[model samples]
Target: MTHSTRSSHPRRRTTPRHPVSPRGLRTLRATWERQAAEAGGPGGFHHLHGPHTHGWLLADAVPELLEPIVHADDDPLEPTFFAHLDAPVAEALLARFAPAHLVHRSNGSPTLGNQLRATVAHPGEITLHGFVLGPGRCDERLVSEGALVRFEADLLVTEHHAPGCECELLWAYAVDELGLDDAEHAPHRIHRIHRAEAPDETWWRLLWA
Candidate 1:
């Protein structure tokens, strides 16, 4: 999952933190090592942002690429849903959000770089992608989920959720990211139908077979 390099980890908190086992930590570290190797080998450590950025550092990128879709109120590709994005960016976002429904959230915020961030994930991928569309350079990275949790803990994050099949939300986030372009690239027809909900008690009475 790719997200913004900026710090905005406090945006969502519904998912609570669970203890990390010693074995889990070791496994996570191994995953991180592999990620670092993919990024030209871990040449020591570097500080990107925050205090913990000094270990096995990975670059970052804008978070909106995937976060806004799942977090959208309804249709992930709805123009209004991504109004915050520029014309070009919005168009790209729509292309990615195809095969979506209009079920939207009462509240949605586009504050990836400025004040918030979005976590983009995909199934079968060990690294999480992150980016920041705010000021400074465009930072992006593919980092290990285990290492990210360890780094997050160092930042004193009271709650943490490691990315894996065990966590439904994280799993969905990953799958959604991976499948963003699935609807557009499929071999068969992809249908998206819209239906209005019953307005009142008598609304259902008008239904007919």
Candidate 2:
């Protein structure tokens, strides 16, 4: 009867889509198993940004390394909000966002090569992170059918929650390609540091805390 803690069932989440950069972890897992079997799945595959996904996430350093670790607001490193259609109008707007989730930002740090900056948070009731780079698209499937698709990151944050309540925007992209002075996070590459520290709201108490 020592099972006072039975009826259990709560643990299911495995998300690892190509991320091996410990100096090319076994040649990047054999080139991500041959690019996920020639892009059959494994999420399209594409992280050759830095010396191949952040050159071992910046080998070794020792200064305030790896920041940013937001809690809510989906905080997945928030980015991918879009607009400034450049590269061939962003590939005809990714043929209707091609089922997207994006969340951009990746000048490919490890010393900034690809350069990134994305912020597109859309749900409803007005929420805009870089509001799709502004200049248009208030939502219509993201400009009349183009959900959102335009990569080539390299910037850092973005804001416009004006009316002065709380918009502590801080831009700092390609932080010298995130050459962390002291790093860690190589259990197969997955980042989002900062750990703790988030208490200062305003914009309606951070949109209702």
Candidate 3:
């Protein structure tokens, strides 16, 4: 048998190019990782939405802005980047992803709620299901199991049953504690406010807020 000659140079590992966040996506990733590790099980990534989905969407839609949340070994249903979401966190995320005047798509009606107004009116009560890029359809994909959201009075989100967390609490906090309507940067102050006044620290610490 003839011996084959090998090259001296080592092959370089190829990593796919992704989006980037100005604040450094690694901070978000680190926060989730720490939260998960501290929780001692799967962390906050246990739910359908929450921090895992937040990271996933950022990575998927704008990978160049932040690192990807899901890995090759990640579970399709339960991902691996968990964190408790409170009023400030939810509001910040909503501001980042679901802006104020985004076109609403439910039942194909032009008359619907705008994201900002509804969120402002009712904090923490809105939890978006399905991908944000596609048309809102009446199918299993857009409307997942128990992820129903109902609106009242045109601007307030009355009821919300999301997959992983209780968003209504956050909304209540926004209305009661944060006074989101008056403060333009209320979302930015959620963490501090939550740390100070949340009634159930155990629940907030144990699972997604």
Candidate 4:
């Protein structure tokens, strides 16, 4: 005969779990990585856009200079070498790859809002997620239950706050989709600008001078 024993211990409630999606995290990681950009140097912000926007220096202003340097005729700039973009395409192309990338689709549309909102709620810190590239395609290979959120409070909100934010966020994934991930290895900085001043500025104007 076997005897069964029951313990009189009190039952404890388990903590609620918030599942994170592996797909959304891929883009989150890229954005958080920009925080450590101090090591790469200053131009991080300027290089992104300014007098000197492209890698080939004069190429950004004058696309003609890049035609010769860009050896590949079909896909002249295949993600690796940074030449100059046609002044015409420069703005559009960069916007296509701005923000975090993975969160955007091929046409450069945002794929997530709740995740982005959660991220903005907390600043200065980031949460890493689990997701791997599939079939080497950046499109829909990501597998996530839900994206994790990281809070990083910078002097300013990320420069990715404009209309380009949506497009740029998408382009990176497209490049990854195009299998151009290994093209450029250089470090890039995400611009951070403060928003606190906005409220103060508004108050000052409404009150005195």
**In every candidate, how many clashes are there?**
29, 26, 12, 25
**Candidate 2, residues 88-201: lDDT per residue as tens digits?**
222222221222212232222111111111111211111111222110111111221111222123223223433641222211121122222111111111112121222231
**Which run of 10 residues does model 3 get worst, by summed lDDT?**
137-146
- Provide TM-scores for the models: 0.20, 0.15, 0.22, 0.17
Clash number for model 1? 29
For each candidate in turn, give its C-alpha RMSD to the true structure in angstroms: 20.7, 21.1, 17.6, 23.7
Write the residue-wise lDDT of candidate 4 on 10-118 in tens digits: 1123222223436643322232223223213462323232232222111112223222223222211222122222222222222222233334321222232222222
Residue lDDT tens for model 1, 1-209: 22342243222222222234355333322333343343333443323653222112222212334233212222111211221222233223222221211111111211222111122331112212122211111122211111011010111111233343223333233235333221112111111112243222111000000
Cα lDDT of model 3 overall?
Answer: 0.29
lDDT of 4: 0.25
lDDT, residue 128, candidate 4: 16
After aligning candidate 3 to the native by TM-score, how far in Å is the CA of 160 from where it should be?
Answer: 21
* Best candidate according to TM-score: 3
After superposition, the stretches of candidate 3 with alpha carbons farther than 4 Å from their true spots are 1-90, 93-101, 109-113, 124-126, 134-209
Question: Lowest-lDDT window of 10 residues in candidate 2?
Answer: 62-71
Candidate 2 Cα RMSD after full superposition onto the native fold (Å): 21.1
Worst 10 residues of 1 by lDDT: 200-209
Kindly list the per-residue Cα lDDT of model 3 for residues 23-64, writing each as its tens digit: 633543454344334433434224344222222233222222
